[model samples]
Target: MRKALRLTALAGLFMASFAQAATPIDVYRDPNCGCCKSWIKYLEANGFSVNDHVEPNMSALKQRLGVAPRLPPCHTAVIGGKFVEGHVPVAQIRELEKHPELRGIAVPGMPAGSPGMEMGQAAQAYQVIGLTQDGTDEVLASYPASSTQ
Candidate 1:
């Protein structure tokens, strides 16, 4: 019984360390964008280690990253070699990391109530779009507007 308990404790420790081993994300955003900062804070609060890069030329960076032109762009993030554009939520970001078939994901425009774009009692419906390996846009998830008046 003691040996079994010791092995269980060891397994728990290993699991804890693995959980903390998430890849650090590099976020590039305009220096003057407040929403980007808020998004970074949200990520940090959700247990992500964020490396914030205050970019000077956002359009050029977005272009270089191959962000879809149809997808409304804002701050850009790279995690595990996948581009995360706009205000993607933490859940979708995790899903993106797990899907090797997707090139990237985006929340498109800064819809209200998404992560950092929160507006008190006002939320706009939005879709989380995934850029597939073939460069096609796929709706990965959709969020409804807040019902709170």
Candidate 2:
């Protein structure tokens, strides 16, 4: 009976940790885009459960999601009912969790060194922009181009 109780407690903790880490997200991307797949892997590693929606018409999908044309990226995601575009870092997602007032966030273009766009030792200056419901945006985070970037 003691063993059973211990197992049950372990199971409960496991489920809670999984829930806390995983933020369910539906990703929209082109089936042929390798970078997009890499980005998905980044999210999974960061504890997000991603559902891929591979479609040839990426533009249409973005349009349907009300993604601003100003912030264009190879992929987009719906998470916690908020839009997440491009290779946003896991850390930024944590920030988003804090700012429930914002609608979503995006990294305009796929900059090198950003999660999936990583190239050999090259990181470009990039900004993670936050979007409001009315389509206004602000820079939530900025990353400098660095050797470690």
What is the number of backbone collisions in each predicted candidate, taken in the order shown? 0, 0
Can you tell me which runs of candidate 2 are displaced by over 4 Å?
1-21
Candidate 1 to truth, TM: 0.83
Candidate-wise lDDT, in order: 0.88, 0.86
* Per-residue alpha-carbon lDDT of candidate 2 for residues 69-119, written as tens digits (9 for 90 to 100): 998788888877777889889888777877776788899888988999886
Across residues 24-130, which tens digit of lDDT does each residue of candidate 1 receive? 89999998999999999999888788999999998888788788888746899999888999999999998886788898999987898899988585789999999
Estimate TM-scores for all models. 0.83, 0.82
Show where candidate 1 strays beyond 4 Å.
Answer: 1-22
Estimate the TM-score for candidate 2: 0.82
Best by TM-score: 1
lDDT measured at residue 31 in model 2 versus the true structure, 0 to 100: 78
By lDDT, who's the top model here?
1
lDDT score, candidate 1: 0.88
